[model samples]
Structures are given as structure tokens and as C-alpha cells.
Target: MASEKSVRIKDIADRLGLSMMSVSVALRGMPGVSEKTRKAVKACAAKLGYRPDPALSALADYRRRVRPTMSFAQLAFVTDYPVKDDPFWGYTNEFLYGAQKRGQEYGYNVVPFWLREGGMTRKQASSVLFNRGIKGLLIAPLPVEDGHLDDLTWKYFAAVAIGPSMASPQLDHAVFDHHHATQTVLRQLHERGYRRIGFLILRRRSTRVHHMPLDAYLGHQYRHEEDRRIEPYLPEALTAEGFWRWFDDQKPDVIVTDAPQDIPRLLAQRGLKSPLDVGLVCVSGQANELEGVSAIIQDLKAIGAAAMDRLHTNLLRHAYGPPQHAHGSHIRGHWQEGMTLKK
Candidate 1:
């Protein structure tokens, strides 16, 4: 008997007395093969210890792509963003730019699709993707965290989400390590001799990232004297009244938040200035717009690149749909020193 290393698809087919094409289809979980035959082919291949040759697969993929009749393969980067006044839209682009650049290196195009564009329904949008022969989907983070989108025809494609923002039909995802970033921010702030630190992120931003920011603030606070622990201000709405009330009550010597630039304006309104009366450290994002605030700037482009690499692997292994054991990565960000911290 030949060693399993020498086993090929032909060997599996020969044992079952089936054609190579039928075996290929069955192994890929594609249609046109009977359910019983598909099962048998898989079992036989496993028993024979047959595996695909990576180099040959690469050549085949190249040939299939170069043919004039075949279009360059594409992956869809789907989102549900508004056409106008989209607050988070700019930040979302960092993910797209990274994924797009990485995808180009793989000879794959990453295309964006809007879920609510021109009255097209989610079901219809899915059809467009399938009809266009796209088999990979890169889901953008939802506007609101903890949302579910079950109407998608998930069975036809290999899917990955940008973050944990999606709540239902959980998919493999790549995201920044928020908890790690929080710890980093806290350590830096403490080293600056600040004792009382307060956290404030209006809206569901805290919940969106699974409350890592709020949790980190509390954890750090508890490590200090009980008098140093200040309650965080997390509200559904952003208002001056709420902000001043929280500031008066907490009187945090330094504040950690998602938006440091905007915080200064709010402080100035009450005749207070950052670094004069308070300090600010941003953990959420917008590194460029930090306005001289100490921040843990996320490498969002890396998250996009990681996601693309995962999708490429899925395409290679023929892994489609939601996975039984979904796995992914969390890219870490670096700190950017700004004027908001104490010298």
C-alpha cells in the first residue's frame, strides 16, 4: 500500500469507483452530488489521508483567474452606513483602506455594498452578491453595537465581521484589543501622578466594545485608595448639563474617554481647561484628531489586513458560511503622546 502522503483525489475516487469530478464536487460541499455520496467521499478521503497540493492549487487558481472569460475574483465589504451625516463613517474607512490594499496584494478585489441603498432590501443585496459570484464577505462594524442580521444567506459565502459589534449569527472577526489598550492608558495616566480618573463615553460606545473602557477605569481606580475611585459618566445622550453634573460630582483630576478633542470644548464652556483642571486620555479612536491629548491610537488598518488574510485562508480551505468554531485576532495599538497629559 502507498503511504498516505502519496494519496491524491484520484486515489479516493478510484477506491469508491467514482469519477474525479464527482469526488471534487462532493469534497467541496458543492451541489450536484447526492448527500450519501458526499458523505462517503469525505469519509473515504479521510481514511486514505489524502490532502491537496498547495502549489498545484495556486497554479489552478492563477489559470482560472487569467482566462479572458473569467473575471478577477472579488470579495464584498458590506456595511449599513447612511449616505449622509455618518459620524463613524470616516473611522470605518481605515479598516477598508487596509483590507483593500491587502486584498490587492492577493489579486482579489474588495468591494463595498450598502445595505440600505436605493431601497434595496437585505435579501436583495445578498442576491446581488451571489449573482456576482462573490463568495467572501467582510462585514463592517454595525452603527449600533449588539445588533443581529439573520436574513443574510450566510450559507453561500465565507464571512467575517470587523468586530464584536454584530450580536447574532456570530462570525469570525478581527478587532483592536480594547482591554489591552485600556490597561495601557491607565498605566500611562498613573505614571503621570494622576490619582482620580473618570471615564465618560456618551451613547452606547462603551457597550459596543463590550465595556472594556469603563471596566478598565474601574479596575484601575479600585487599585488605588477608595477616595480615588470616581464613578464613570456613560449616558445615552450627549448634553452639557449632564457633562457638567458628572464633572461637578466626580471632579476627576484626569479623564479617560473616547473623544478627547470634543471634551476640551465642553470644559472651556464651564471656564475649565484640560491639563489645567483635568487631564484627558483617549482609548476609542481618532488618533489624528486627538488635539494633543494622550491617546492609545488603534492600528485600525492592521485589523483590516488581518481580516483579509483570514478570508483568503477561508477561500483556500473552501471554508464557507459561519464556522463551527469561529476564531480570529485582536491587533494591538500604540500610544500617541499629546498635550492633554501632565508634563
Candidate 2:
């Protein structure tokens, strides 16, 4: 017998005494082929070690089908904060959780990149990312001083920011609506007959709280012509000693802030309890318990998930252009009727 070359569809058809088209149809598991014949074709193909050419299959199928490589692609979660000691606590971790969940679904792996040690120059960071095959980037909130990030671009990559707004208009992003969120929270407080509400913000002028809540408070006060007060403490002044000094002097009836754990404890030290002497609400309520705390509740996990969805759309659709200003989903937080708020 002639040296039998690896069997092709033609050989199977010749052995089965069927037309090549019928054998091809049976092998493809297409309709019109009898079930018995389909099984026989499959068995013969398997025994002959016959493999379909993927390129030919793709051409026949017309629709492109790219199988994900078993190896996971790296996705960079870049931020300016220190990796080990992020001041926002669960904020970055929750965002990573969302990213990782989506990444696993799409056969990719997430790798966090912290720009510590004086930060990496854009060129240096880009080179490192390129070398690592990081084609997707989810930029967490960067300080305003980080300068222009528009220079960071790649041919086969998609990038998104995960904060309220990016200074650079050249990057796509999804962020919390601090202004609207503050407005909603304050309006709810006002409706609940809390006229003398006060806002306590950390001293850092660059922090988002300084701009969102503080500004919204000022704006709401002007719009309603209601008497209002705001006390700004140094970021370091978030300590118990520093909070007490301001609390003693300002004496806000109801306070809106982010530090539920520390600030509420300090209030109790002075023989004050929420909803009785004063009401307390936090802008970002990631604290362990909300029994006595009302908060705006920034959903960091949703923000991360939205960022990944946007990145995936951009990559798959080949949407490359200057960053488009896209608004993210703003989940309006409900005013939890904690003991901290009186009905």
C-alpha cells in the first residue's frame, strides 16, 4: 500500500463511499447529515488524526473567532498612591475586586501597579507596561499634580480612569458624581428639617472631598439662603485631638464627613451621641458598621466594573480617539435611618 498520508476529509469520503460535500457536512455536525453518518465521520476523523485548518475554518465561518490563549493577559491598575499603605483603605481594594472579577470572566489577569518611590515617568511606565504585555489599563484616581496623562497611548491597548473626572480630556473614564451625590445628600438633610447642617472636610485642598462636598455645601447654602457652616481640618487633623478642638468651637448640630470610626468616637468622648446631640453622615461610608452613620456611600466596586466594561468595549470595537467624556452610572445613596438621624 502507498504510504498513507494523514487522512483528509477526501480520504474519509472515499472510504465511506460518500461525496466529499456530504462527508464535510457530517464532520461539521451540520444539519441534513444523518446522526449515524455524523458519528461515523467524527470517529473516522478522530482515528485519522485529521485536523481542520483554523484559517480555512475561519474563512468558511466568515465571523472572526479568536480563541483566548490559555495564558492570562496582564491588566494594569495604575494609581499614584503607595501600594502598601493606601490612605483610602478599602477603596482601591474594592476597585481591584471588581476588575479581577471581570478579568477572570474574559480570561485575563489583573496586576496592580503602584507608582511609588517618586513615581514613574510616563515614558518609563509605558515601556514597562509594553514589555509586560499589559494591553489594558485602569487608572485609579491620580492627584491633580500628576500632570498630563494624555501622552500615554498604545496601539493595542484600552485605558480608562476610575474617578469623578480626569483633568486630561484625552482619556476615557468613569467616576463618582461627587457634586450630584453631595447635592442629593444635602437636599435629603434639608428636607428632614436639618437647617444648621455643617460639613467637616479634611484640610487637604487637593482632596476630592474639599471640592465636591465643601463646594456643594456652599452652593446649597447660597441657593436656599440657609445658615450653614463648614470646618476644615488639616488632613493630619483627622486625629482625635485635632477633631475635638474644631468640634468644640464650631459645634455643628449635624455633621457630614467621611471618617465615621474616628470622628464619632471623638464625639462620644465629649459626652455626645448621634441623633441626640448631633447627627453624623459620612461621604464615603466604608466603615465596619453603619448603625449610627448615614453616608453618601461611594460604590467603588461598581466604578471598577464600569471601567472594565468601558475598556472592553473600546478594545473590541477598536474605538481609538481622543478621550471621550462619558458619564458613569451614579447610584443615588439612600439615607439610612440610623439612630444618628431624627425623624
Candidate 3:
């Protein structure tokens, strides 16, 4: 029997007449080696009773992560938004930061690639990315629409979507769990001694995320008495008259909305005080500068990091183009205490 120190990968290379690098990659189960070569290397190692040193593997992983090696690869963070630095893209900024941070740990650089930049066509952009040795693409969330990948060369790169907003490419995706977020909001409000919880979202916006918030809130409401259930304030076009009408009619104790910041300003028109008149809980991103609104805090940075991890897996497995069966990753968020509701 060969001891771990006695037999080495160089010996395995000598036995098979293969390069030590090939043998090492094969033994580590990394890509770039053929299946036949990998099998032969494994068989030869077993025959020689070779064992790997655990200390070496740990040190390699530590160095690769903690002090990441040279950046040898790049991942394109694809987006189609016309204005890259607009305030509307704040969420995009956070997601990009997370992805870039995670990519650095794996010896990879995350670079943003605007789809409409320089008026370049999709094919031109694809060729540029491929020629630059970018084999992975992280599709950032854009407007909700089908056929997001039409006419683009899709067979070259392993791709992943940052959120549910990207409807095409049929690639793996990571998104905040909207349904879980709404459930958290409703449950937390009830626990805080508030009933008649109401939900409000734009009619058009609700459909974009598959009506998840609406469905989750409705599911919670139906479990109680009919009178305690408040119909969600979903309107095609929301106005002060319409919002106030719904509020006066439903008379909810707490109004949960996707627009916490906008709601306070709107409420001031009627001189309706929050928490004193109606509690507000936000399912969307909270404005830290704004106060008195409770919220479900989403770990968007983690979601972005997870997206990079998923894309890296596909790159490792050589899963390029659209997958036959796409997998969706849903990351849940936690509750944030605020002065919008009283205990």
C-alpha cells in the first residue's frame, strides 16, 4: 500500500505518460480534462493506492477564497437599461456590488455590459464578450418581458439571472421570495396586535412578480372572519381620491404597501397620521431617510452573491446556453422593526 507522502501525482503522471497538471486537475475533479483521461487517472491512482493530503486541499481553498489568486476570468453583468446611473437602478447598484464582491473571491472579475451601450447590436456585443474571454454572463434584472434573448448568440456562455424580472433565456435565476415577504409582513402585524391588515400594490406591478404579494396576503386574510379581511388596494391608476376612497371604505388597522415612502406623502393630503390612524408596513425596499415605516428587509446582496455562485457552478459544469429545465432560487427576507406600528 502506498502512503500519502510516498506516491504522488507526478508518479501518476509518469505511469500514464500524462502531464502532471492534467493528472492534478483530473484528480481534483475539475474541468478541462476529458472523461476518458480522468477515468484512467483515477484508475491508476487507485491501483497505486494513492491518497491525497487533506492539509494541502484546505490550504488551497483558504488561499483561493481569503486571498484570491490572480483574476484569470471575467463574468459579464448584462443589462439593457438606458440610464445606467439613474436612481431607479439603485437595486441594480446593490446587486452589482454583491456580485462583484463574490466574483473576486473566485479569481474572477464581474464587469457590467450594457446591452444598448454605444448603440451596439446584440450580436456585436456577444462577439465582443466572447472574444474578450468572458465565458459567463450574469443577466441583471430588467423590465418584465418575454423573449429577452431573441437574436442574441446564446450558445457561448453560462448565464444566470439576478432576479425574476428577466423573463427570457430560461436560465437559472435568483430572486427575493415575494410570497414569503408578504407572509412575514402579515404575520408580524398580527403578532403586534393589529388586525384588518390591508395590502396595496400597483395593478401593473403586481402582475410582474406573479401577484405573489397579493396571493400571500389574500391567503392570510381568508383564514379569518369575512369582516376582518380587507380587500387589497390594487388600482390601475392610483390617485389621492381613489386611495382615500379605498382607505375610508375598508378602514384597515394597518396598511401594508410596496410604496412606504410615497404613502406617507399621500396620507398627508388627508391629514391622516400613520400608526395613529393606520400602520404601514413596506414589502419593498425601505428608504432609510424616511421614518415611521416598518418593513421586510431583503438580503439582496446575498441573493446577488448566490447568483454568482450558481453561474460559477454552470461554468464549472460547462452548462452553456439556456438549460433544458431551469432552476429558480428564492431567497427569503427578514422583518425590520420600525415606528410605523406600535406594540
Which one wins on TM-score?
3
Candidate 2 structure quality by residue, lDDT tens digits, 9-40? 78888877888988886765333467588778
Off by over 4 Å in 2: 1-73, 82-90, 115-121, 143-156, 164-170, 226-251, 287-291, 320-334
For 1-343, candidate 3 gives per-residue lDDT tens digits of 5666699998999999999999987886555588799889999999998888879867876788988878457789988887765577767877888889998887778998888888989999899988887889998887564437756788988889987776776789988899999988888888989988878898878877878899999899899889898888999977888898998899888888887877888878878777887798898663454355688877778888989988877875567799999988898877777888877
* lDDT string, candidate 1, 7-104, tens digits: 88888889999999899868765445776998899899888887878798788657644642222478888888766327658788888889988887
lDDT of 2 at 162: 76
- For residue 273, model 1's alpha carbon misses the true position, in angstroms, by 2.7
Q: What does candidate 2 score on TM?
A: 0.65
The Cα local distance difference test for each model comes to: 0.82, 0.67, 0.82
**Candidate 3 Cα errors over 4 Å, as ranges:** 1-17, 23-60, 145-147, 287-290
**Which ranking of candidates, highest TM-score first?**
3, 1, 2
List RMSD in Å for every model shown.
4.4, 12.6, 4.0
Question: Candidate 1: lDDT over CA atoms?
Answer: 0.82
What is the TM-score of each predicted model, taking all chains together? 0.82, 0.65, 0.84
